[model samples]
Target: MPITLPNGITAIELADDYPALQIETADCSATLALNGAHLTHWQPSHTAHPVIYLSPTAILQQGKAIRGGVPLCWPWFNAHPTDPDSHPSHGVARIERWDLISATVEDGSAIIELELKASPVIEAHVPFPFQLKALFNLGQTCSIVLETTNLAKENIAVGGALHSYFSLSHIDNATVTGLQHTPYLDTAARPEKSAVQTEGELRFQAETDRIYYGSDLPARIHDAEWKRSIVVEKAGSLTSVVWNPWIEKAASLGDLPDADYQRFLCIEAANARHDTRILAPGSTHRLETRFIVENLS
Candidate 1:
């Protein structure tokens, strides 16, 4: 059976694998996978390429993390810093399904909300009581707001990222701007090294994994070959992670095509490292980011 929202958004199971919501507006269309409340695709009517990228062989199984789009990393990131081997990487949010709360259309845009609360599956791992909600405003630009509320009486530590994979005409033709003069941890370096970015624009040549600190500015992806640029803006985040699996790493991944790394870049809005939040009981923290594609010519 198909589920229809009051604003005519359609919810249907995809490939008998997982439930997804479809949103169409006068300006754009998007697909949201409920398993992670993940925004898988977004395309403005005027753009030639999609603003987001989804891997061709991405796994859509119920408890598996889809390989692309925006995967929500929450509660903790990458792994628990103190107990790396004891916790799941990127937390529990991306592997669980979220409930659609509402979907509405206004002024040629689609506004949607999805919610997730702590359950037995989640408690079995961390045992922290919390409520997570995501609000999406999709149109010519796509914006998302993730709010996490602590339900327990004590304070809770949390960190996360909107692990966004953006499409590019070619990795060599893309450069990310706005992180100039920022300091970052080079994760690809042996034992990890800290460095300052002196280059005004960051270009890709090899495997890249750097966590930039204290970044509150909007970053821009200039795709010279595509003649377009993608502007990424964010709030409530003090860190930005830039990554690309360049060759050997990409080949080892089962879900992503080896050569697919040449077509996308991951510039994420994150609250990791020294910026992790400690939420007081009854308090809420919202992490938001917006993506807008513009023609260069």
Candidate 2:
């Protein structure tokens, strides 16, 4: 029988039949789908395409854009230009399948918990053998929770992040505020420079790629043309990443349209290189990020 959770949420039990899970919230207003127990689609509003969608049903990675969707990429942020064994551009978890344990729907949202036990497939590529639990909560205010437990006898080195691709009407008319006087590594220029201080809000004048480190301030993106601003609050993770491919790099992504990059920006919470964290046996760590869409008009 299908289990009916709180807040008008329901979970279909198909663990023995197939690798699909469905989560529905109260009022039957919103629904999120999972394949192989990993988040696939987060549809907030019924009259739309979707708020979040992950491509390749099995991989749980590679999110393709549609409308106002936010793609969730985990474990790693961007390419480690210096390291090759870091596991793909981000990490191995994105491509691996996760197993669902339970779910709860409450307060106009649904929270589904998924777990992954280390296996030969993951161990072959990733040296660390650890247990991972990803709690994905879908609602009007959605959040994907990531928790890692060190199960291996030896201490392990791990790096992780949540990459959120926000949809915007226009990039030129948007300004990001919050990070002030924060230090960041500017990846746009050659020789790779770092900023000790920022003049003001970071604006997308051209192709921008910078990783801001050690900031607890909340950041916001104001879309002047759309009359809407998105506020982001971070907990557990201290670093913030802002990226816009602009013109040049956007053209290289064959899956993206020529004008797509101008309409979206990636504000990610990441840990890389020097910021990487390690976990010892019987230890655990967590990272969380929240997005609130508010009306500016």
Candidate 3:
């Protein structure tokens, strides 16, 4: 029998392949994949375009990372900074399936909680006992909270990100604000140069990859073509990242179409690089981000 959730939400199998929970409310609708606790679709009422983007050619199989829509990069971000030959790049959380703990509706919003515990496979990669909990609130706005607790006897260092891909009408027409005057590492530059952003707003014209340090303020993506603004606010994070594969690099990604770069932009909230968290045994750390969409006149 299919699982039943509060507020008339339904648990259904997607393509007869993976189990997923469907959330519907007066203001929005969403789909949460059981594997990785991935949220693949979210559409607020009265919006023409989805706030979150899922790649057209994304693989949804077990033990694979879906190309878009807020993939959780836990324990580590990107490749292992110390190990050049680390496999699978961004940690093991996104590939491991998560268990749904509870689902409920409160104040007209659908709230879902999922959990992941360390196993033999996870311990082999991370070598630390840990438990992860993800809480998602879907309404007119989307809020996500990720909490990690160190279950090991010793302190553990952890770094990760909420890799969010947002839909856009055109990449060139969008301007991201609130990161001005921040120092960032330009990873696309040869040898990875560090620089301070002088521009009042960031506009995309080429392949970009930058990790902004000490950025705790909310970032806003204003899309002129779409006549909308997406504001991303966060807590318990000190670093933020912005990335886009413009032309040549986009063509090289197997899960993403070559021309799909024009339709989305990624503004990730992270604790990566020098901001890695050192959690004491039995201590818990939480990273949270909220997304709100506003219509432009």
**Per-residue lDDT tens digits of candidate 1, residues 1-297?**
333585536777765869998878788988999998999999987788888999999999977888889998887777777887766778778889898887888887888888986788788666678889999999899999989999889998889898999999999999999999999999988999999999998999999999999999699999998899999999999999999999999999999999999989999999987889999999999999999999888
Q: What is the C-alpha lDDT of each candidate?
A: 0.89, 0.62, 0.88
TM-score to native of every candidate shown: 0.96, 0.80, 0.96
Q: CA shift at 126, candidate 2, in angstroms?
A: 1.1
Q: Give every collision pair in model 3.
A: none
Number of clashing residue pairs, candidate 3: 0
Report the C-alpha displacement of residue 204, candidate 1, in angstroms. 0.2
Tell me the deviation in Å of residue 64 in model 1. 0.6
Report how far residue 179 has shifted in candidate 1, in Å.
0.6
RMSD to the hidden true structure, all candidates: 1.6, 4.6, 1.5
What candidate 3 gets wrong by more than 4 Å, as runs, is 1-3
lDDT of 2 by residue, 1-297 (tens): 444456455454333423445555642244333432344455454323333322222222222222223333444555633465644656556555556567776676777787766667567556666777777667766676678778789887666566766666678877898888999888887978998655677777888888788976578888777676677776667677787888888777665666777767777766655566678898987776776666675
